[model samples]
Target: MPPLPAFNPSTECPPPGRFPLTWDEIESELVKADDFAESSTRSGLLEELRVHFALVEMATGAVGRLWLAGSFVSGKLDPEDIDVTYLIPSDAYVRAMADPDTVDNLDNLGTKDWCVRQGLRVDAYVLRLAATEDFRALGVTGAMAPDDHKVFESLGVYDEVWQRCRSGPNGIPRGTRRGYVEVVL
Candidate 1:
């Protein structure tokens, strides 16, 4: 074979401050999404988005949880965007990404547009089961299904939070005027 191209760090690598997110950070976002999911006025769009990926696992056999993270979960006011991730089994994650149909399903989900309509940034990812574990922990069994529930349980986010977000908050009355149009997920 011909000589391989030499490695180029500058062009190939992310610059300073741009790094793959850590498990600890994901844990923190669990808290943030839980809290944000609690705020009735703020969580309208997010709540609607909770179900867009229901068909994800069925389509790919990727058993995992969905996560919302980043600056929006960091308690920053008017964060540039909201970050979401689908934590799935390692084998399934690879397969899903490689399949065009899976990609198309994600595209049709319109997660990014929904976030933008609410005036927020959107950074989403699909993390493998192993990557979701706390490497620093002494006894890490790796990810489990129902993976999403495990994430919330591991991160100390109560079912009440999930329950509230799922049940739908008592939103503002219609025809009463609103700054942003309600999104349908």
Candidate 2:
């Protein structure tokens, strides 16, 4: 795999592209990129990400893919929260939705508002399951279901949105954009 790229100076963001990494690698690399003063804050934010991941897996049985976006993935110092996108397979989504016990977890895992209410410093979103570069571990095969089309569409939107800079306090992007990293499970 290629090394993680440096932040684009102008936007203070990661260069526009996909960087697939592991949890260990994300901690070792992404965190180390921040200044010394930001170390503790970065660690705490990473912990929140771990908690968010566990919640997603508990609710869905599997996270088809995990994506890291927003300021947390950028070169910025002391980002308030980490933005995460969990791509959940349809089968897992159905199971999670059908279970009353997992509803709150699903709800928390699905939206940014619910996550804030739960006191999780994670801006979360769940999209139609996406295929990783290597799908073997994820149990996705060569076969493409009709719904895969929607998954592609969903991913495209994420790519487009995440690639842009959060222009103002409201996060309405006004043209400027950046890149994000994907967690390799």
Candidate 3:
């Protein structure tokens, strides 16, 4: 497999300090894996999750709950992207929007752009707490499915799977736009 690209969070115009694991950082974390065990993915996922969650906490000043609601948690290894949901309180939205820095940081453009800039094939979404029930249901159903290979089909899961089973336009959106940060790959 080819190496993943690096990501730099800093911008010349507004100058947001670099965030979380850069491409080098992610690679180092992945390289430390003993033999691509489940735990290895879990560790790498956790690292990425922490970085994403920290950005939310720092930008919103509100600590929200995070749930792994996509292929990563559903036993799918060939995930095209990471999927997660941030349960942010409704009350915090206004405050977050009032602050330009927070709003700017919350934009998918910044996150996506950062990943592309780093050469990493990653995409992220932010979903509000209120929108998670459906996602949670989808995740649970996928997890309980009998066939690991068929789990994606069982719940109509896609985005991070092998090409043969990739979903079409009906596939779930890469990320939800309402939450603070719903998905990251």
Highest lDDT scorer:
2
Candidate 3: tens digits of C-alpha lDDT, residues 1-185: 22322221221011112123333433343334333354435555556556766776777666454433334422333444455444455457557778887777878423766754644334555433332234445456554323333433422222222112223463433431111112222
Please tell me which predicted candidate would have the highest TM-score against the true structure: 2
Worst 10-residue lDDT window for candidate 3 reads 9-18
Q: Number of clashing residue pairs in every model?
A: 3, 4, 12
Which lDDT value does model 2 have at 144?
A: 58
- What are the TM-scores, per candidate, against the unseen true structure? 0.38, 0.81, 0.44
lDDT against the true structure, per candidate, is: 0.42, 0.77, 0.42
Residue-wise lDDT of candidate 1 within 37-71, one digit each (tens)? Answer: 45433343343334444555575685565654333
Which sections of candidate 1 miss by over 4 Å? 1-41, 76-81, 107-111, 114-122, 130-185
Error of 1 at 25 (Å): 17
Worst 10-residue lDDT window for candidate 2 reads 130-139
Which candidate would rank higher by lDDT, 2 or 3?
2
- Candidate 1 backbone clash number: 3
TM-score of 3: 0.44
